[model samples]
Target: MIRIIAVLMLLIPGLISAYGIKLMRDTLFNDFHPIFFHIGIQFFAGFLFFLGGVAFIGGFIVYRDKKKKKQREDN
Candidate 1:
């Protein structure tokens, strides 16, 4: 369903960040520039969050309009 797909899309960035952090910790460069890794993850996560929020809002607006149109057509 659309809702399920939307939820999964929103979860993608968190999953990516978790995997990225794990990979970074496992690598030899883990001790160096830790702040960079954290910052990069935060930036990506924030971007994804914003994108997901916009998509959700757009979907709601579309659904609302459709419902109103359907009601007017029935009347």
Candidate 2:
């Protein structure tokens, strides 16, 4: 269950980041006023990426460690 949640968390951010990148690209091409808003969006996207990445990595580490421990015990 935790692993499934972790995968979902990772995937959600990745999908959002892809769309956000495309939006940023369009923003760059278009004449959008208030560049500050774009900057804020970029920061938010980056934050989401960071958060999702950390959670996925941490969950994988924990899962792998547990699996290895279980194997060791069976030996």
Candidate 3:
């Protein structure tokens, strides 16, 4: 159950990063998303979203790994 919950939690950030990639792609093609008034703003927001999501996922995995390693050492 905990593993399943972890997988589900990851899906949100995965979707966020995917959306960020889409935004960046649209910016590259000169087709701006209507959410932002300017191209630069859209691109910058997308970049932030991508980095934030990736960082969250990376940190979660790193933390989990360290915890597991500690448990192994204790046993």
Clashing residue pairs, candidate 2? none
Q: Count the backbone clashes (under 3 Å) in each candidate.
A: 0, 0, 0
Model 1 Cα lDDT, one tens digit per residue, 1-75? 998976786566556555555544544443444554575564554455555556665666577678788534443
Supply the TM-score for candidate 2. 0.42
Candidate 2 lDDT (Cα, 0 to 1): 0.61
Put down candidate 2 lDDT per residue, 17-72, tens digits, no spaces: 56555555555666344543675575556466566655666676677778787434
Clashing residue pairs found in predicted model 1: none
TM-score of each: 0.42, 0.42, 0.87
**What is the C-alpha local distance difference test score of each model?**
0.57, 0.61, 0.86
**Which ranges of candidate 3 are over 4 A from the true structure?**
70-75
Best by lDDT: 3
lDDT of 3 by residue, 1-75 (tens): 998999988889988988888888889999977879999999988898898889889988878888887434443
Name the lDDT value of residue 8 in candidate 2.
85
> 27, model 3: CA deviation in Å?
0.1
The candidates, ranked best first by TM-score, are: 3, 1, 2
